[model samples]
Every structure is written in structure tokens, then in C-alpha cells.
Target: MTDVTPTPTPTPLLEVAMPALLRHARHTYGAAMRAALAARGYDDIPANGLYVIGALALGEAPLGQIIRELRVSKQAAGQLVDALVLRGYLEREVDPQDRRRLTVTLTERGQAAADTQREAREGIDGALLACMGEEKVLHAREVLAALIGIGREGE
Candidate 1:
């Protein structure tokens, strides 16, 4: 008397390295967002500027905080900020609570671009949800957050 079941075959996805998977996944979002922004006449946004814009849209985070998140050198961060300001996507203003400090805020054009970027991202999210279902998508987020936390642990 025997009770036997067949072993499952590994999927092709299992063959790909984690880093490669992450890079391509990022490219998917990046391409979608860039195309959407460009279609709306925001083609001039500098590299990594989207991250700055998106972070600011979330809240009034300090430039230092954005720099840390970007993991870019201080000089690079300074250059990024300068480009964004010059591009009319950001404006330097006196900090309301700290009169001695200057803060950067998004201009009207920046808001419009942010909105377009967000919609593009949401479109990808919606597609993921539709294909993967809610439970699977939530699990994917959990896995990604854990991976992000691993990087943070080194700091």
C-alpha cells in the first residue's frame, strides 16, 4: 500500500537572482512613471528628482532625510536640489517655523507632475492587485518591506 504525490517543478522565476528581479521590477515602475510624466510635458525632471518630489509630496521632510533615503553623496544631493530648483519644480522659501532656515517646496508644475507620477504608479499597483489578488499582493509588500529593513539594519 503506497501513498505518493508528484514533486512540483520549480518555476523559471526561481532561477533569477534577487537583485536582477528587483532591478527589473524597479525599471517597470520607472518606465511607467517616466512615460506618464513625459506625456504630460515633464520630461525635464532630472535623474532621482522623482524620488525627491515624491518624498516631499508625502510630507515636508528635511533635505537631510531625503539625502539619507537616496543614499547619495552630499555633493550629489546639493546638485540635485539645485537642478530641481532651477527647473522650476521646486522653490526655496523661508521656513515658517524656523525663520533662519530655508525650505524647498514644490511649485505648481511640480504638483502636476507628482500627480501624474502617482497615477502611473497606482496603475501598476492596480494591475498587480488584479493579477496577484489582494492576499498575494499584501504578501509581496511584506516581503519587500523585510528586504528594505535588511538594508536599514546596516546603518
Candidate 2:
């Protein structure tokens, strides 16, 4: 019999590009949260809308803050917030401190969605902890946060 050589599987493109890998990870997390929300009769919520919802999960915040924190264009942020408002997941009110500014707050339904998203995130965190161990996962989070901080320093 002739000698045979084994071929190795190719690495995924995401693995080669750090940005792509981070994006893929975000997409995967978003998809999981969307699926959980849909199962709870929240199918109307769009994938991109979660960014705004999550930003407001802690409490109400100005539209500009959400746009900046999410790193999305003003138009895109406005569109997503408008859609969420229409879907009854969010409410926009004039800021008392700054009448010119609008604050986006979560409605009862929006709070539910945020809760579901948190649960999904916890599940993902658990999975990552299981696979990578607590130390590694925590370290990874630190590394990502540091990287993000570095990017912000440029602004």
C-alpha cells in the first residue's frame, strides 16, 4: 500500500481576523438572545434593536449615549429606537434636564425583553466558563475590555 498523508482542516476565516472573530461572537450571542426572546412571544424585536435595549437595561439613558456606546451611526440608532418604540418595547421622553435631548426608557415589555436578554447572556457566559474555565473567561473579558478602551482613547 502507498503511504498516505493526512490533510488538516482549515481554520475558519473568523479565526484569522480578530475583528471578524469578535463580530461573529457578537452575532452568535445576539442570535441566541433573539431565539430566547422569540420563544417568549417577542418575535417582533429585531436583532439590532437589542443593542439599544441592552444599553437601557440598567436604566434610562439619552439617545446620544446609546448611539455613542453602541458605536452605531446616529441614523441607524434613531431607526432602531423608533422601531422599538413602535413595537412597544421602548418609550422616548424629553429629558427634563435638557428639553432638547430625548431619553429612551424601557417599557414593561422592554424590561421583559431585557430580562430575557440577560438570561441568554448568563447562559452564554456559563457555557464559555465551562469551556474555557472561569479564569480564562474572565481574562478574555479583561482583554476585550482593554482593547475597547484602547480604541476609545483614539477618539
Candidate 3:
């Protein structure tokens, strides 16, 4: 038998590039989350779809509420919801209280996807907690929350 060793992959240049570090981090996290969710049978949903499903998984909500909570434009949120509905992950229905308004809710499939995504997030959060410790994780969360609040205030 010929002796052959597997070749090692090269480290990407962007991994060490400062300006693209944040983008790399975001991509890495998204990839990890996607992989984790896929392992749990959520391969059909993209990250954006997962976010939208997550919001609706809580309970049925008006279209406007989803747009506001996600901080996305009406067109963007509608597109996302439409895609999810097409994929059979969500159902759009007329609100019982207000027939004129449309409400969106997760279907059984969407609920499963949301649960898998939530579990993946918890896994990542737990790893971050282990790496940074509870105190630092809490501090980081506070900082992020503050930043989000400030951003909304400015807008």
C-alpha cells in the first residue's frame, strides 16, 4: 500500500485580517448555528428564515409586530414570511380579533425548526459562557442590549 497523508488545509487570509474579523466572526457563528440546526433536521430554513420563525414561534402575531420586533422593513419581513409560508414552515391567517389584519404563526414544521435553532443558540451561548465565564458573558449581554437600545433610540 502506498503511504499517503492527508493534506492540511490552509488558514484563510481573512482569519487574520483585522478589518474583516467581525465579518468573519459573524459568518463563522452563522455557519456553526446552521450546522447545528441542520444536524437536528432544520436544513430547509436559512438564518433569516430561522429568525423570523423564532419570533412567530413564541405566538401568533400581527405582520406589523413581526416587522417591528425584527427591526426589518415591511417588504423584507413580508418576503421572509412569504418564503417561510411557501416552504410550509409557517401559516398566514386572518386575525380572529381583527379580520382585517393578518397574523403569522409557525406551523408544526416551523416550531420544530425554531426549537432546533433555539437549542443551537443555547449551545453556542453555553460555549461562550464557558470560554468567557458567567460574569463576562453577563457583562457582554448587557453591553449588547445597551447598544441595541441606543441604536433604536438614535433611529
lDDT top scorer: 1
For 1-155, candidate 1 gives per-residue lDDT tens digits of 77688887989877899999899999999999999999999999999999999888877787779879898999999899999999989899898999999888889988888899999999999999999899999998999999989988987
Instruction: Flag regions of model 1 displaced more than 4 Å.
Output: 1-11
Which pairs of residues collide in candidate 2? none
Over 1-155, each residue of candidate 3 has an lDDT whose tens digit, in order, gives 97699877768773576447656755766777689778877777744776677767766675566678777778877777788898889898888999998767788888888887777778878888889899998997787688679878998
Output the better candidate (2/3) by TM-score: 2
Look at candidate 1 and tell me the lDDT of residue 12.
Answer: 87
Q: After superposition, how far is residue 65 of candidate 3 from its true place, in Å?
A: 3.1
By summed lDDT, which 10 consecutive residues of candidate 2 come out lowest? 7-16
lDDT of 2 at 24: 85
> Which segments of model 3 are wrong by more than 4 Å?
1-25, 60-62, 69-72
**Candidate 2 structure, TM-score to reference:** 0.81
lDDT of each: 0.91, 0.85, 0.76
Give Cα distance to truth, residue 32, candidate 3, Å.
Answer: 2.5
